[model samples]
Target: MELPKVGSIGEYIRQQRQQAKISLRQLAAQAGVSNPYLSQVERGLRKPSAEILNQIAKGLHISAQALYVQAGLIEDREPDSDVLAAIRADVTITERQRQVLIDIYESFRKENRAGNPEAQPTQPAEPPPDAAVHRENTATPDSKEG
Candidate 1:
């Protein structure tokens, strides 16, 4: 996919901010960025980092992934399901909390796929050393407890 121009992304952000009925100064304050920096970003004179984009997304009450796609940090793919969209759009939860929910949802999907008999088996990957050690430590009987 062709990457969107930085100016286009900036324009998109400007449009979103306007559509949300938020002033540039208010957005910058909410996003925890300086007014001049935000102005530069809106003018396409500055490219924002992922962290800044996340803050801006939160301020705009939108998904960070949407901004990431517009910034060309990620490829624009198929639209998310209504459930996933709702999860991402929820403003009451922190970003970390949203991510945790998404992780759990994806894990359940993977588990469901694994149970399907028609699914092709893939080669198992080696577990990380820390995970291996954790399993071993939990599996062993506590000799000291007795």
Candidate 2:
């Protein structure tokens, strides 16, 4: 059977643990894995198999399916509305700014959902530097003599 590439699974495990606010030693004891081993796994230097992943999932109190998707062991559905809303609501911005930003975001989202790139706004170009632009410039290879 196929296994997820080690690095992705490790990264995902680490992210989930951090988000859950679990300490490495605590989680290691809970998952029945050595702290050093779990640390290596979290750093993407080791790939634990399904049984171990299931243990970790149980310790985290989350579905193994979620970890599987993170590990790239399984395809996942798009996040549901509640999950998406929760994420959107977690922003540090004030509610009024969030609403305004959400309105702009939703407008583009509608265009994307409709498959209409032409409906997108054109971004403004950056301004050119004034005459004060100097070249204390770390000279690039392209600027040097052949």
Per-model TM against the reference: 0.51, 0.49
**How far is 91's C-alpha from truth in model 2 (Å)?**
12
Q: Which 10 successive residues of model 1 have the least lDDT summed?
A: 132-141
On lDDT, the candidate that comes out on top is 1
RMSD of each: 14.6, 13.2
Q: Residue 138 CA error for candidate 2 (Å)?
A: 62
Candidate 1 residue-wise lDDT, 14-122, digit = tens: 8778867899999999999999999888888788999999999999887788789778788645355566667655655655576688778777767767897655457
lDDT of candidate 2 over 38-134, digit per residue (tens): 9988887777778889899877765686567666677655455454355333434433454466567667777877978787656797766664666
Q: What TM-score does structure 2 among the candidates reach?
A: 0.49
Error of 1 at 11 (Å): 0.5
Candidate 1 local distance difference test against the native: 0.77
